[model samples]
Target: MLHAVIMAGGTGTRFWPASRAASPKQLLPLVGKSTMIRQTYERLEGLVPPEQTLIVTNQQLVEPIAEQIPELPVSQLVGEPCKRDTAPCIGLAALLVSRKDPDATMLVMPADHVIRSRNHFQSAVKQAVEMVGKSQAEIVTFGIKPTYPAEIFGYIHRGAAIDTRGDSAPSYVVKHFREKPNASTAAEYVSSGDYFWNSGIFIWKAKTILDALAAQQPEMLEHLKKIVDAWGTDKQDEVLEKEFTAIEGISIDYAVMEHAKNVAVIVAPYDWDDLGSWLSLARLLGTDRDENTIVGKHLGMNTKGTIIRSTDDHLVVTLGLKDCLVVHTPDATLVANKNDEESIRNIVKLLEQRGMTEYL
Candidate 1:
């Protein structure tokens, strides 16, 4: 059988007042009618049953997640005491699900990504599951076909092709993973035609991943093993709290996949976006012919290539502005040049430095 683990524990500070500690981006209806997390699981309906899906999130978000996706069983939703990153989260999910079905193929996905083509996305996942089922490979990640020279995203070099004979015909082996590059380097990657955007979506056998973890991230694997050994028993709470508290924070990319030689990449053709910042949302949503983007209630005069979003009932009026972003929430309003959207992280850093607790 197949199991999907949705990682949903991100703080989502880049979104600022719209995304806060109490309501992160995953739970907010920024993309469409439904929250990103709900849309993520909803897309996997016929491919994977509700019982087979697992949600790994923070302890604070457990109830909120439950309220959003009530179809998921209480036991299937795993929570970490703190944000220890994807390494521990994967280790925890691998341990829990492997116990139920050792041969289960796991599809690890972020809860906040937007995949436009739902049918194509599901077909790709089914193909990935079939591929992992037949091979000794421990892990596989989906690589999105690059549409632009995006410096904000990491790049993956594709190797030999995989037979994804679907309509999209996505192909690649992911020869190597590259960090986020400068504009010039990103342009080079775009011209080379061998680079794909790292989608951060992964699939693998639960037991096979555990074996890889034992080889690469041995110490972290041992820490997670203690909790797995106690699951379904009265000692689960005590062991989970003690072991997870002591575990170091690390991403699965650094701790496992980067070091594992048996890793593979499955090229996929789906309009995808991580929505890391408001700028990304603006581009994805696009603008009118006049180059004006408005969400919520807003009035614009002589504004071109500008994005205005407001959650409050108050009307936002922009005059003679071009290539800018204006976001108004109940608490804070953000005004920046459209080109400077990625630097909003600096604003977050400054808030942290100034000890502004309420804003974050």
Candidate 2:
């Protein structure tokens, strides 16, 4: 059997006022009418039922996420007391799943990403789950063939091909996991057909991952075990808050998968995007002849290769603006050169520094 865990704890600082502390990007509808998390959950419609799926998000977002994904019982929406990254989140999820079904295959993914072709995505997921089911110890992850040299995403090196299922996508033993590279390095990685942009979607057995966590992240695993022990008790919230915050914050790649043996990668069949920033809308919403992508009311005289987001009531007009990002919100508006997209994080930090809590 398979269980799903959706990691939706990200603050999404890059999205600014639209994606504030109360409502993050996952809760907001970025790609389509539905929220990102809702889209992700819907993508798993026939594959994994709501009863077998859970969401791990911020403690403050529990109510919002529950509201958006009402099919999931509030108990299944596990909220972290603080930010502890993916390792502890997955570890705790695996522990809880293993307690129910030790042989369960776990499908873990971020709630903010977009994956089209629901059938193809489900097929790929089934292939991954089947592969992991065979070995039980194999940690399987999906890898997207990079369209361009992406400096932002981690890369995975593929080894010899492993699984074959009636002309399905190839699965390979992952050779190495590489960090985000520089422009030159990224170009080199793209040139070499052996590397893939790590998609962050993973499938593995609950017990196997728990064992890996125990071996590689023992202290973290102990904390997770203690938290799980107190899951249904009166001390559930208190124990989770104390132990989870104390547990070290580390990515699954850094803490376990990078060191674990029998790790495999499945070249994904469906289109994918992480939607890291407002700039991502260019890829999703597409652009005009001038290469300007607009989601709402925008009138640009000379705007080319820019991304604009504004509602009907708040029309954004730009003159002589080329390759810029304009996001209009009721309280705060963001205007920046699209080339400096990474600096969006700086704006969030600056707001915090200036004690502008309302904007954050």
Candidate 3:
């Protein structure tokens, strides 16, 4: 059986005023009319149905997520009691899904990424499912074709191509993974043409990934074992809450995938964006003739290459400003250089210190 688990637990503090603790980026219509979470579910229509799809998010978000995605069965919404990071999120979802079907090949994807080409994305996922079904490998992550020398994203080096015909498409054994690089390194990687932007989307069978975790991260795996072992018993949820606390807060990339030798990379050709920070938001938005990405009602004067977004009806005017980001909400209005967009996370931290929870 094939199933998909969308990890929607991120806080998305970088997109502050717009994305708050109560409603994060996944629930907001950042890109278009629908929320990113809804887009993720819609993207998987033919690949996996709502019955086979699961959404893993924080316990606080369960009710709101359910409200946004009412089509999902209540049981399919897996909630984490605490923020245990990606390792536990993945492990918990895998454990729950495996309980229903042992042979489940799970497509573990993030809920916030914007993948434009639906047909291409679906084709790649279907191919990866067929490939993983036959292999004993533990994990498979999609690596987006690097369109530019982006220093923000990690890179995946492709190894020998699998023996598929020309129509076989771009699938490769991951040679090595690289952390975010400097400008020179990023340019070198882009010039080589083998490096891919790590999309953080994964695929693997439940048993295969569990075995790899057991091998590479025994401590995390042992803690997860206690939860899985209690499945179907009356003590499952209680045991899960307790035992999950004992696990370390680490990403699957650091705890397992980076160390596991069987990891594979499926080269995804579709346009993909993690939307990690405000800079990413500004970069990926649509622009008008004045070269401004205007979200709400706005009248600009000589504003070029700037993003001005406001939920309110307030009119925004920019005078002789280029490459700027202006975001206006009821609580706060932010004006910053577009080049320094990633620093918004630091601004969020400062707000937290000042006890500005109302604006956040």
* Model 1, runs deviating above 4 Å: 163-168, 353-355
Query: Which one wins by TM-score: 1 or 2?
Result: 2
For all predicted structures, in order, the TM-scores are 0.94, 0.98, 0.94
Error (Å) of candidate 1 at residue 356 is 3.4
**Which parts of model 3 have CA positions greater than 4 angstroms off?**
136-138, 229-237
Q: Residues 267-288, candidate 3, lDDT per residue (tens digit)?
A: 8858899988766765688667
**Which number leads on TM-score?**
2
Candidate 1 accuracy as TM-score: 0.94
Q: Summing lDDT over every window of 10 consecutive residues in candidate 3, give the lowest-scoring window.
A: 161-170
Indicate the worst ten consecutive residues by lDDT in candidate 1: 163-172
Give the lowest summed-lDDT range of ten residues in model 2. 129-138
Q: What do the candidate models score in CA lDDT, each in turn? A: 0.85, 0.90, 0.84
Q: Pull out the clashing pairs in model 3.
A: none
